[model samples]
Target: MAGLSQIWAHIYTTTLVFFSILFLELVILVRAAAGSIHGCKNRPITTTQYLKLVEEKNPACRYKTGLRMESLECAVCLSKYEEEDEIRKLKKCNHTFHKDCLDTWLQQDWATCPLCRSMVLPEEVVVNYWRHQNYQEFDGSDEELIFLLSALHGNYIRRFL
Candidate 1:
């Protein structure tokens, strides 16, 4: 009887250890699944929200250098800006346009400009045009473009200080 009792105690201890390991593995699997699904379930920012953000942040919208606000056309859509229009301004380039237009245009195209087949940076399309025109004769490659962009960013940061 004592031998039987000891056997039962050993069996119970082994079962408990097995179950604890199983429970820990299940917890890890559940956490991994939740992380992957979380990203898939979430939606990106809407176009309207993007436009409002740009309008609030950019000082360019407040005033046009010499061009009339009405004369400005979206480099992506070739459409002019209208009141309450949702638009995004390229960070590297100062081009503004309807968000929907640019989003659709970028989906199909890769490097070429939406308006012209000019080699310009995707985000800084407007500034890229000016940069290309000025630096065309300077023998600057893509690497040089990147270096110039970094220098410009540093200059912008320094001006604030």
Candidate 2:
């Protein structure tokens, strides 16, 4: 009987220790996951500051210009932009289109500009302006120039086509 009691006590103690360790590990994991989510939410805007280094006027130019140009007719549907019309301005590339037109076009998963198939950055125009102003000192390489030109070509193609 004495030996049996000792064995039973040992089993209970070992089980308690094992469960306590598991609970502690679970608590640590939950805390670690919560901390990582908080960190991601608060991640600093280092890219915004880097963009500021190449600042020019009209950071949100695409949104503004697209709204203004919305009054003009949509090249895709040949329909006028009405105040009640659902519209979507392409990010960084300030081309505006009727939401219906854009959604239908995007359903095709085409990345080129709709009109010219050229690239446009409504926001980065400010950056390009700054770069152009300082071109003599900070001119980009030939490859960079080619890339920019190609993007411009694409934008024009979408606009005209």
Candidate 3:
């Protein structure tokens, strides 16, 4: 009878653990789904904000000893990072690259680390990188001009069709 009680206790403990794990997993899944539906879009930050975020996200870039390491190479320029060079590091993956290089790369629709291809900004930024091109690419055209250009593209498409 004692052996049977011990077996019963073990079974009860196992079942309790299994249910706990299932509950945690369900909570996580629900949270993830909700986040996907309501996550904020990413936006372009000011130069100072960008620099601050880079420093906050990446601890490795905080120190500069005026020496270049053989292992520390900028994937964008295919060159080693000079100690004097400003470096930016991705937050999640912790991959580092030259600040200028990564800045140019992130100007594209997708803001991803060159090496890991992970997003350069955290998901919470909620900025639409794809629609946001390089600021320098804009010509300060009026809103009417933009609308006309879009209308022209549609008309051309119709003519071709």
Candidate 4:
């Protein structure tokens, strides 16, 4: 009976993981289908908001001090991070990279970290955090946020597509 229970438990755990992955994939698919604009359209942030989010979360610096062995290299450029190099450490995945490289990647409209492919700037999450930060300047009535959001959301499509 003990061995039977163990087998059943293993099967249950495996099935649960499989279903979880399937559900997440379905969600992603539906989200993608429901969107008109490409790139980080699901939830986009402006450079200003991104900088604020970075400051509130991981905080970039002119250079990193090599506190860890893994963060010494920029994944995008495949170059070693040196003194006076601008570094931005992602808050969600904790992956560090050259600021310019990451910015270029993001400007190309990617919503994920290059290494982990994790969503870094999902709008809801950041806005919720800003709300918690007492960001009265970030509410729905703000004109700048609206303009920037429109620019990020559809300007490229209008300009290039």
* Collision count for each candidate, in order: 1, 15, 7, 0
lDDT string for model 1 (1-161, tens) is: 99998777667655654564465567667866766786732323334443344344432332234544433677766766666666655553445556667555543454333554543233444333333334432233656544544453454322222
Candidate 1: which stretches are off by over 4 Å? 1-71, 111-161
Better of 1 and 3 by TM-score: 3
Task: Judge candidate 1 at residue 113 and give its lDDT.
Answer: 38
Per-prediction TM-score to the true structure, in the order listed: 0.29, 0.30, 0.43, 0.43
Cα misplacement distance, residue 61 of candidate 1 (Å) = 9.9
**Candidate 2 vs. true structure, TM-score:** 0.30
lDDT of each: 0.49, 0.50, 0.58, 0.63
lDDT score at residue 111, model 1, on the 0-100 scale = 32
Worst 10 residues of 1 by lDDT: 129-138
Sort every candidate by lDDT, greatest first. Answer: 4, 3, 2, 1
lDDT of 4 by residue, 73-108 (tens): 899999988888888888888898888888666545
As a whole number from 0 to 100, the lDDT of residue 102 in candidate 2 is 58
Prediction 3 TM-score vs. true: 0.43
Q: Please provide, for model 2 over 1-161, each residue's C-alpha lDDT reduced to its tens digit, 9 standing for 90 to 100.
A: 99998778667655654564565567667866776787743323333443353232212222233455633776778877665666665554556676657545543423344876653323344344433334442134655444444463454323222
Clashing pairs in 3: 40-126, 41-125, 41-126, 41-127, 42-126, 42-127, 43-127
